[model samples]
Target chain A: MQRILNVFVKYRNSILYLFLLGFSLIFLKANSNFHQLKLEKISLFFSSSLYSFSNSINRYFRLEKENQRLLKENEVLKSIQIRSNTLFLYTEGCNNKTNFPFDVQRVNIIKNSFQSQYNYIIIDKGAASGIKREMGVISAKGIIGLVQAVTDNYASVISILNQDMKINVRFKNRTTFGSLIWKGKNPKKFSIEDVVSTSSIKKGDTIVTGGMSSYFPYGIPLGVVTNLENNIQNGYYKIDAELFENPAELYKAYVIENSDFKEINSLMQNIKQ
Target chain B: MNSQILKMMGSFVLLILAQVLLFNQINIFGSVNPMLYLLFLVMYPFDQNQTFYIFIGFLLGFFIDFISQTGGAHTIASLSVSYLRPIIMKYSYGLTSERPKSILTDPRKTNNFVFLLIFISVHHLIYFSIAYFSADAFLLIIKNSLLTMIFSLILILLISSLYRVK
Candidate 1:
């Protein structure tokens, strides 16, 4: 027993090092598996506080630029409203729920780190705001990202700039669809692989959500198609899309709240089971 | 000893905040990120216990990893640097009877700063390489490493120049 004690004492620091490293690695692995309790709520609370602090300071610092952007956006919105009103006359007692199913919650982008391989965006919204996992996010300009994890006061949206991102998008007025993904080369451009050969998608054609995502309503703006080609493998039409919103410049965003998301998720889970 | 510890802790906080808030956000290319945070581990006073030094490295790395969500990249990188710090110090400053804490060396010794630069560069290379293991972008890695090294050296030198150790 004394000999064992001596040996243990001799290598106490190394043992502690191994122990701590092992514990941390285990925690990381477990957290990665999606089994660990999501600390997103805690993240949300802290991030929201951070956002509030930063926003006030930034608002003061960048008032001129902010005003300029607001003016531009306001003018664009006014034009859009005018065009829409002229194009569509509302029929008596007609409700177009299909046009916008998701309640958009505007959240400020608190922190953004898209330069890294495993990049995530922190926004000021949480369980308190009814934001949850898998809900889509969008900016006034266009589709931005989807909520990956949610906490009570803050949530992380996986930016469209992420290389791992895959969203179901199709050309406007076309049945054919393809996956839009970032090429890790440019933030503005993303390559859409596996677009079918039959789809007559041309450059500058608008692409939108295929109505397949439960989070987003059908026909939400993605971006204009910039390039199209047939891949060597699956022979699907591959397209490069110039995303509407600049991920780098994203300051404000909207978290989509779908009323039917729970029902859809439950049904999907049951089907899988 | 107490004042030194407090100063070290204060410096570490400053380094971390500077790293995440400003430097991490500024991407010169797609690859270069300024790693001023490593200076905390790099410039620990020689008198500190080796185990404590390693622990500090772990904490700094772990904190960075948590915020950045890059797994154990920082922790691994920090450990490698801290582990090799003694050897690097021995090579540059010679074996001193003093503890491993940084001492006020003359600013005129560009050779010492160059040695320190090489040490930090090697540490960063090990770190970036491990962090980007599965990535096929070899040229990107090299570019990032070079930029990071340059940025780290400049930042560390600037801080060192400004810092007055009483």
Candidate 2:
């Protein structure tokens, strides 16, 4: 016992450093899987209170401009909704047009970024507002991204501009589909790969979500074709698209909650078997 | 010791409040976020109890991390900085026998300030890199870290200069 005490006393600093470092590493590892409930809840409350104050300040500052923009966008949205409803009526029995199976909650973009290759946006909606991880986010102009993290009344969105983000995008007219990637140099541009050489690709074509993702609905606008190239080795087409919505200026967005998301996810999980 | 503890707590709250309320919202260039909360860790009294300082640093970082919801990246980063801070102060600032706080106030404090700034920048860089760890997007991590460090250094320098540390 005396020898052990002496050894511990001699190496106390090293022992303490190792122990602290080990705890930190373990904390990080555990955090990747599950968050502490009390901490998360407290954080959510704190973030929400701050968000509310900031949001109010923003509204006070930009009331007139935001009102005008919203009015214009609302007019456009009403017209589009009418047109879509008419189209749905005509294709009532066709079964090809499945109305989006999600609930979309309107939200304000409190903070946003697009210039960076790994940009993220903060919206004024969160778990308290029926939002959760993996929900689709979009605006009147186009698809924005998916929910990355959620507090009580606020959430962080991983913008499609992020280099880590890849989504199934397809040309609306030519039916050419590919995986879209942000090349990190330009906020307005993204590269789409995996289109076969046989695809009838062209510039000035509109791109939209391919519905391959369970989060976003089919036919949500993505971008327009800007450039196309052929991979000599693989003989596949790589298309560059200019996104319609400027992610940096996203003021109002929609958080889509698919009612059947759980059911679909469970089914897909089983399909892996 | 009582005054030092009070100052530590005061800095902790001030940093966290600034981080959550102001700096977190100020992404000036879409690529830069000045993590001013790191200032607390950077400015902790060099001669403060090592274990106590480390605990304060971890708590400060944990509070920020909890709000940002990026796991424990900030906590780990701040802990590392606090652990290394004493060594840095000793090497760069030279711990004088004079009650350690006075050594920090000398006008020839540029070296110490630079050391502190570098340490703070490294903390922010590591925190951001770990928060957005992606093997495929290593370039993004590098780009963001550099941008954040640039902003963090500028902000920390400005604050250190303005702080009337008597």
Candidate 3:
């Protein structure tokens, strides 16, 4: 009994180290079989509350800048509203939530990241605000990201800067399209892979959401081509484009819940099976 | 002893708050955001129970990960560093490893600098690895780890110096 007690005291730190390390590794959502949803909910509860509280404090101090940006956005909106007044049929359907293709919810971006390739953003709106998983999020200037996780008062967005994110985009004023994937290193630039070199791409050709997937509405401005890497052997080359909306300057965003998302998803699933 | 414990607790909250609020928000050169929360474990006095320090490391990492929404990446990295810190100190400090507090006491010491480089680099490597979680991103992992380490080292050295014992 004395030897056992002595042994326990002697190696207690190592034992504790192994135990804690094991416990943490098991709970790691990246590669662990932990209770994923339960842990996510618990983490969401704490993290969302912390971020929102902190964001409110920050938002208080940035009221002036926020107001200026809001004023600019409001002007653009006024002009848009005025133009839409000429099209009563389109305006009427857009006002009615059911007839609208996507439901838009305005949320303050509490946190944003552009440094890491696996970057994510957190917004003040969430499940309670009608934001759901796989919903597209956008800033007024351009596309922002897609909502990945949601809680009651907050949601996490897979920012377009993330290397894992592949956005379906097509050249503006043309049908040729490809998927835009962040190539890391630069925040403002994305490399459009799967774009065939055969296409007569220009130096500054515009890019926008393809809208074929129905994730985003048709004709949403994304970026303009900056450079191209052409390789004859591969037949597929990289098209580098500079994003319209700088990732760091994102403040307010709209979570877009596609009305046809469910229908389209089911159709895809059925077709696959 | 009690007052010292309170001071440690106070800094624990302050450091993590500063990390998530201030440091996390600033993205330098568009890629490197300093992981300032690692400063707590770096300056943590090893005079305390080793097991207890490891637990505090876990808690600190968990809290940061919880807020930052990186899942358990921070938690795993922080705890691993917490466990390996003593051994690293043994190497960096060599003969004087018995007096680990000396490393914190004299922030300008050569041994302390070595310790910080090895320690923060290891932490950043583990963090970026878990973050990317892909074998294909081997080059990326090294790039991020090195870049973030430079920023983290600069910040940790400057800030932790403020608390350096006279």
Candidate 4:
């Protein structure tokens, strides 16, 4: 008993260090598995006081750029409005009149981060504003991210820049599709994988969000293909693209809620089962 | 000594607030966001209780991790670096009783600069490695750590020099 006590006393520092190290590693694992409930709420609380305040101060400095972006978005929206007004939705399968399932809510990003592997952005709107998980977010230029977690008054989005987020995207004007993922290498670039080699792809091809998952509506621009390499072993093309809306420059985004998301998700799950 | 603990606690909160609010926003070259929160551990007094320092180091990094939502990468990196600081200081100052009061206040000592660089690099490497957390991104970890370390080293050194007026 005396010898054991002396051993523990001598190595007490190392013992404590290891204990804390284990505690942190456990936290790391919990967070990685997306099981962070209490910590996430605490983060949301901090976001309101800490991030939002700084964001407001920073907003004044970027007024000129923000105005320009809004103007560009306005132009895009106006054109879309004109086209929609001129056209009509007529489908043979469904007799019900088209009520767009997607709801677009404009929200300000309190904090945008792309430095880490799994980056998340905090938006000002949350449960009070009808923001919920699995809702897709997009900027004026392209798809931004998906809402992964929500708290009252704030929602954390898993940005497209995150390594864990693989967005389903297809080449413009073509059915060829690939899953877009970030390599944690560069913020401006994304890699498209699992593209069959037979798909005719070229540099500068436009990549847009695929509506298969019902996350983003069909045809939201994502990026333009910049490079392509044939993965001979997998017989697929490893493609890279430069994003349209650079996340770092982004200040505002629209949180889109799909009214039929749960319905569609349940149907898909039922089919799988 | 009592006042010192109070100052440490005060600066602990202040530094983390500055980190999440101020430093985290600056994305130099689009990828290298300097982790200025590391200043606390780097400047911690060598005479303080080693065990306490190590534990607080974990909390210091854990707070950053919580704010930034990077899991425990910051916690692990910060904890390890604080644990290794004594050994690092041993080599950095060559067991001199007169460890420079401040890394930059005693600017003539080239060892101070080396110490700062090593500290930042090790922390950044461990940070990027854990944050990336995949053998697939080994090269990315190195590139990110190097770029971020350079910027972090510069930012901390620049901020510390403000106190070098004495």
User: Each predicted model: what fraction of the native A–B Cα contacts (within 8 Å) does it retain?
Assistant: 0.07, 0.27, 0.59, 0.61
lDDT of 4 by residue, A65-123 (tens): 99878866765573353224223322322223244456677788999987788888999
Q: Which regions of candidate 1 deviate over 4 angstroms? A: A1-100, B1-166
As for TM-score, the candidate ahead, 1 or 3, is: 3
| Candidate 1 C-alpha lDDT tens digits along B11-127 | 888888788788888887765787888777766776667777778877887787777776666776776677567677777765653333363454436545855676788778877
Q: Is candidate 1 or candidate 2 better by lDDT?
A: 2
**Minimal lDDT window, size 10, model 1 chain A:** A85-94
Tens-digit lDDT track of model 2 for A120-194: 999998889888998888888777888999999999999988989889876785567788888887777788888
* Each model's lDDT: 0.71, 0.74, 0.80, 0.81
lDDT tens digits by residue: candidate 3, B1-166 = 8998798799899988888888888988887889988888987776777889889999999888777666688888998899898888877878643565645675448988999899999999999887777677899999999999999999888887776633
Misplaced by over 4 Å in model 4 are A34-273, B95-108
DockQ of 2: 0.13
By lDDT, the best candidate is: 4
Alpha-carbon TM-score of each model against the true structure: 0.41, 0.43, 0.43, 0.44
DockQ per candidate: 0.07, 0.13, 0.24, 0.26
lDDT (0-100) at residue B7 of candidate 2? 79
What lDDT does candidate 3 reach at residue B63? 86
lDDT of 2 at A239: 77
- Considering only chain A, what is the TM-score of each predicted structure? 0.64, 0.66, 0.66, 0.67
Give per-residue lDDT, candidate 3, residue A160: 87
Task: Provide C-alpha RMSD values for all models, in order.
Answer: 26.7, 27.2, 27.1, 27.5
Which structure is stronger by TM-score: 3 or 4?
4
User: Which regions of candidate 2 deviate over 4 angstroms?
Assistant: A1-99, B1-166
State how far residue A40 of model 4 sits from its true place (Å). 22
